[model samples]
Target chain A: MSGFTVYSATGCVRCKIVKGYMDAQGMTYVEKDMKAEGKEDFQKFYAANRRQIFRGPEGVEFPIVTDGTAIRQGVGACLAYLYAGRELDGFFSAGTLHKEWVDGIHAAGGNPAAGEKFLAVVRLLKGNNFKLVVDTYGRNPALLEKLLAENLVDVAVMEVMASAGLAGAIFGQPLAQEDIERSVALVATAPEYRFQTTVVPVAEGGQARYLTPQEVVAAAKLLATVTRSKKNPYLIKLYRPVQPKDERLGELAPLPAAALLAYRSQARAYQVLAEAEKE
Target chain B: MAYPSVYPTGVTIYDPKKCWSGYTIFQAKEAGALLIDMNGTEVQLWKGLHGFPNTILPGGYVMGHLGLRNNAFGMQDQTDLVQVDWDGNVVWKFNQYEYIEDPGEEPQWMARQHHDFQREGNPVGYYVPGMDPRVDGGNTLILCHKNLYNKKISDKRLLDDTIIEVTWGGDIVWEWTCSDHFDEFGFSEAAKNILCRDPNMRTAGGGMGDWMHVNCMSVLGPNRWYDAGDERFHPDNIIIDGRETNILAIIDKKTGKIVWQVGPEYDTSPALKKLGWIIGVHHTHMISRGLPGEGNILLFDNGGWAGYGVPNPGSPTGSKNALRDYSRVLEFDPVTLQIVWQYTPKEAGFVHPPDSNRFYSPFISGAQRLPNGNTLITEGSGGRAFEVTPDHEIVWEYISPYWGKQMKMNMVYRAYRVPYEWVPQAERAPETPIERIDVAKFRVPGAAPLGRKKETAIEGTKPYQGSTALCIAAAEEVDEK
Candidate 1:
């Protein structure tokens, strides 16, 4: 385990966020897309670390990471380790850290050598304990396809931005729906992957340009149509607007807790795992 | 989740000493609503629930909808509205699931309510404090969605918006659906035919077919117009707006008929078009008898795509048109339809219209006529709510910092200003009083916070090493999206 390998998801934003966090800490690791060979490529890695990765009675769920010895699975489990420092003690029991790691960095007075946040993050992600990133597949995911063809990756995950009516406006960019659908199809067939979206409203200029609750359900239905995974977890995350003020998505409102719940109820029609993530 | 001294969070651009003295209440799209003073201290967390059209009582009780259940095992996000005491106790709870019944229909039950709800007897729920000429008893007015059908209207099943008044005893005293009075909405023959074919509206239950999304509705309350003998402006009249069709109308609550409306066709009409197309407006409220411009309509003009564009003789009836890029706030006399005052990006100090996107939220913005003659506007999408004087000077402003229960971000739905007298224990803490800063000169100190950490990866490179090289193409492109 010279450099712990990450079976990266096809297109998962959390995977990206996690990787970014790790980069700030200066932790080293190798990244691979799990969908490289469809199920075949994922199967090899799955065989290597089968037990530590799988959970529940049936052995499902993925984005498994191993230092060739111990392993970590699921975003929550990995975050607990990444933020909790070394020892993996209380890793499963303690859960995610709510303290802002950047606060420690800020307190360091710009001295990267004395940065406690970086040191803590690196210590937590140390050794064979690699990470898998996730996000919505990028436009024209030819790289994702090529990676899937290679079968030399970890896992895959994606997110549905909005339903058909809002496909073009919400992201402040051309969504490239054909590629999204293709990536969705590829991930759905891949051995291990997840799909999600931030249930937040997009505002352009000071007004709300976010999809209505109706559009959220519509997007879920669209995802349901593409993925055969009946229980495909559509992780509806609480939205956090992009920082430093990008001109495109000015400001956005996150969906309300209750309205989000009602939305999950509405999405139940699609028979997918409509889950809400507390930001 | 970390950003440096974010706007709408921690009083970024505040003139605490200059703002009207009182607490502002608003629910972040993700975080539950909070009541804070000029100093930006949380008077009440009112956690566990999301604020939508929430109001504070004379006591310390906060009334709002149950936002998200963080501890629940099943569908945690249920539509259960609650009233909490000062200690955050559940004083009253209305589960939309158990209630919301419609008589004489097969399923009979309406879906969960969204956007707005009003408590009739209180008048406290009204945007302004005013006296009502008539008493309808204490009932809650709810804007709800339901799949409905009627032979009198189109036979095709439709997702209709219904306004129902429910009593504390759990009885629906009155019910009104917009679809029933379809003929009165003033749609052209072509518009009507096209709407029947594709009534563009969006919602979770309606899939992609929700037509006439009634975003906000409230009993007109007492207004000068009624005092001046305009029966149409009676306190009991219910004023509502259709986001999809862009129809701002006053329905005679007694007759349940739309007596006056401004849209469904602004482009075709001279009077309406000059006032500008009221495309996708929200939070329509009569200024109340006591406010400065009482009887005038205060509307947040959300400029965006709405309605089925009527076809010209040569063009098809179902023509689609691009929405105007700019949004405006209009305060107009309802009877004369004359705009008394207005605010736009240009007025907000923007150089050009398109640059005013900061002022334009195609949906989810609101306006309030404060007692001090200043208008408190919630640029809802931006999550920035501020108060501006009659002269258009911004005095107080806040951006919501709490991310919602489910999402990492939060945007405000609407915000209201209340006098210090309104909150019983309003002075739970001392006000720190913030001084407005030169934002251009301000910067967050130290290494960039987590949110400020920019992506620094080289194109197609891994953290460690591998001989696979990389995709190599599209490598120069940024990953900002």
Candidate 2:
């Protein structure tokens, strides 16, 4: 069939947004509320593709759009495919970190082809009037500068992966501090920007330790110095390792809310983002 | 038939030869103590009789509580611990433990009994071949709650766990409070700081700090360790585990001091390192003497959230400082802290990595070693109970069909398997082995057939002629131009 099916639940805000966008665009599709009239159909569909469904902490994600062969989950991916004709896999979206692009860069080994392909996709998406949001780890300074110079990104987010002592655990290979500084400086030039760091457990010498309050402060100082603005929005997100890639990091215990607040308090140089701003 | 039959609930699998066939008793979430035989046939059910856990005594006697205190006054507080015979007559009762007046409620005595209790004859409260629980007379050791404040534990009022042994005539014979031995728990300075401030405070009991939230407690009973000069594993020693604190400790009945323990910390030794962090654990007990793995410490190491320590990314508050996804049934040498036998997903025969969570229950579960060298596991959070042999082959399985109206989930607090002869009032059901249903084939009536590779047609569009794939390709082609 030419149309796709959108599986949704009641009171799901993102599901409503996607349906609204589709309606305004005059798109023809079927809507299935998993809890109500379409429960049986969803169940049959779910049973057939049980292994493919992504089960996260909140259980199954909603607004699942299936076009027979390819299944797009969550509002981000559904909108990306429906609006911009971009199929995303593994939580890929315009707003989140560009992990797929980073993986392409890693696979290309200093080749410019990966960068050109990404820029092309960005242009294609921009042509569709999609509000572009990008998150980067700042591994490639020149590429980040190019994106900023082109004025292609609406909102830019730079994620500070780790503080000094914990960098080796987070970054697989050594990333130059100068490159990170350049990327941070470039990211600030965007219309809307945020410096975010997710406090996660880092394994070193068979032991795991969380980024201490002092460590978080060091990252905040770096961001402040690079951007030359204490007003820069910095978000401290507590990571919940539901299914972590690193097995050793899984052994570490979860930090309590008090410690996170303590970390937020210690980073006086950084301007904290409100809770609603968190993903 | 009450639920969607994605998979059948009662008796999905049964292997009578491998399983130690018995009458499985558990408190259905709706209301009642239900006894099911080997075939998952409902043999008997005592309506209106509920329990944090319903236990079956010898000679057809069922033990449970009649009612629960309002959540506003107490967390999981039972009003009266009572026993009833085959005809549902209250044979014995106890409630004179604490007297309190909840807001807008009458002042009355509350048993305050919560997670667990054990009678004198049976050490673990479940059945063992030679040691049947006394139906006529036996003192009851109850794991109850006591609302009190101790500055050493926290500044707020503490909902501390208190073990009390009460006679058949409802007289308190002995008592031990958890907060009294707080210092002996060996909390680090950081953990202590967090504890003093929070103590895992809950809104129940008008903002009481449930510091130790001890979920399970039972007497050690006759053990090989005790017989071989390990005074710490004495027959009368009480074993209890704190759900909030990640501690499984034994209390000396005479002195009421913590003598043997395994967490709040697990890395103190090499053996404990292998055992890992036992967080949010339950049903910690020494295996009864007649059981195969007797003298070993058995517990359902429910690896969910618990403990106090330096905050990591996962636990932001540090109050519930530890976190893990999978559950493990661990049988270990308590003295050496070495894991003797374990039932993780690996043991449960899952092939893929990270499959450990497939056999997990984050909260409210238990393990019992049976006479036939098999273990009956109550994966309570999912309302599933199954029997596993020494090889970890699931010989029998049953999922509880009774879903709670208030909680909106089918969660069994605990389950116990007693010998068929114990409940002679009901005839034993014919033991028919039910094979595990093939999930791929099971489907609701009139639903689409599964595993067929036919293209699914989207509504409001013609099938095959203008398909979704072609539509996506057409859109992509337009973008490319």
Candidate 3:
């Protein structure tokens, strides 16, 4: 098997993790840091692969993944490719899905008729993987249940309003306890889905609410009960603070190690509890 | 012998055995003690100065160091400005004060008055002070005041990195600062994360500092193309480089905005990241405006920063820091911002060591467009200067042996060639014959033998026995001349 190449720069932790993943797989690769002298050849190589180079601040920070022919941006995208067991050809292809869908429409006996373009669009949607984007605001519980029962989506990511105080301030709509309970009941009947809550620090007095390990565990437990499954769900706590400049917001303070460890331990405990409940 | 005389146009020409001819004052090496002439003569001009003198111009006016002083940060033991006449008399002087509390005071006053004042540790002033003069016909001086780590007052005051042009009376007429427009500058989350994590990013050490560095300012229009409308000709569109951020910026005088800038934006295209084009560049200037590189700018791409210079063993990425070999004089289109033409040692036919590979040291260098379509380049780190023809052929070359105390760091800073018409004859220094020597006859015996066979021992006979007798005969004949 031919190995891949990774172009990276100094002090990039994401690049390090990508390289580490490739190493764990026992994959051979050549790493080039474009910030070196006499590496002009590699620079040209990367430029040819990606039409335009992305310069990081300080003129460094790149972790490019390539299997000799195609390149991808970050380790997350590269891992997605590895998981799919496919090369990065379709990822950057301009209209690969459109072409595939056109051919699929023809095969479905959708004759080359007057409405062929409309049928082709439907065929394209059915040909490849796409998760439906559903905006839930005052959405009826019955409609959500019907969609869930029909297995319309392979996976669903639903945004849940946290509390009346936060919901009124953030969404400009007062959320009742009955509304949240009904939504939770509808989601609990669905097997393949997840719940996520976005926390705006500004809504909470410009300070991110800190959840203790036990509170996080309890929240995960309640979320798992609503999902009606033993699979531990992800509780992503987001902090969106109001910053003057976009650049200032780009600078994210690292989570304190103690808090991170506490969160991780709570997640582990939640997973253990879910596994035990399944048994 | 004749005494040097001055002409009306301020041009100084040398008579036989009278004054130094066809030479411009480049820089005072050995810490302002010895002056390196354009013709490669290092003449000792003064003594007992620590920092290099800032400006050396005509009319017997030499402005530089008076002595050392201190400030709030630390002891800036080598900072002062003194105006000396042709007779070596200190006519005017300024010493460092504690601080400048008023925001209305001209930035140049703070620079001239403070010893510790620097534009982010970079010596502020002209590279070759008198090479370019103010257009309005006043004694020209360039002063830089760095404001990276200083206290922020107002949005206008935040543009602390300042370069100013003042009259002889110390009135600030023209100035350029960075903070006026770069306030909107943005960086990506990843890049900002790295900067915030790195402690050295805000300090003067490790090249990154709070003060944006504004180094090496030049005034135009003392030449033929002094147009009032042309932005490049505007005596105020100063080109400055931030030593830490590796940004070459051109500031517009009218709006106090960065008219042109090249560096990493928050969302940079992938092609630029691959090329690593903007790392540690300096000495920016507009070259070949109406010529072959028309509208293209030239600069010394220092390539010194995170991955520049020698390899660091403690680097997070186990990669060696690559030293820039062969810094090129690149002509880049300001609009598309692409390199159009470039000059390197190999293409220019300059010789390097056999093991040098492709590495050429072009550190802290400068390039100037010549009248005859050639380019004058000063490879500051190499302590060498040469003239390259339009086709990149080296027409003239000179190696400076007038190594100054800064020679240990192996830098020449800046150099300039005067047209011999700029200096007044009355103020010109006398010419002295330079002694030259050849080293071919001084080789010692070979430490290694070529073959196993015993070398023939012909060493007993002298190599130049006949040449010695001929020299004595020639000396007797030279009793006349």
Among incorrect, acceptable, medium and high, the docking class of model 1 is incorrect
lDDT of 2 by residue, A1-279 (tens): 348888888776657767887887788789899889989988998898876666555467777888887776665566656654532232143122231221111111122334554555455445555566766665666766766677767788777744423554575545667766777788889888787777877776678877776777777888777777665777777876645465646567766443464555456435433121112
User: What ranking of all candidate models by DockQ puts the best one first?
Assistant: 1, 3, 2
Model 3 residue B102 CA deviation in Å: 19
lDDT of 1 by residue, A18-106 (tens): 56666776767777666563456567777765644543443434344445665655544444455543343321321122222111111
Better of 2 and 3 by TM-score: 2
Count backbone clashes in candidate 3: 14
Give per-model TM-scores.
0.53, 0.59, 0.43
Candidate 2, B185-216: lDDT as tens digits: 99988789889999988898679898988999
| Docking quality (DockQ) for each candidate | 0.01, 0.01, 0.01
Give a tens-digit lDDT track for model 3, residues B316-366: 421212334446666666555666666754455434222122324434566
lDDT of 3: 0.44
Q: Write the per-residue lDDT of candidate 3 for residues A120-156, one digit (tens) a residue.
A: 2322233333333222322244444544555533344
TM-score of chain A of 1: 0.48
| Weakest ten-residue segment in model 2 chain B by summed lDDT | B466-475
Q: List candidate 2 stretches off by more than 4 Å.
A: A1-279, B1-5, B351-353, B448-481
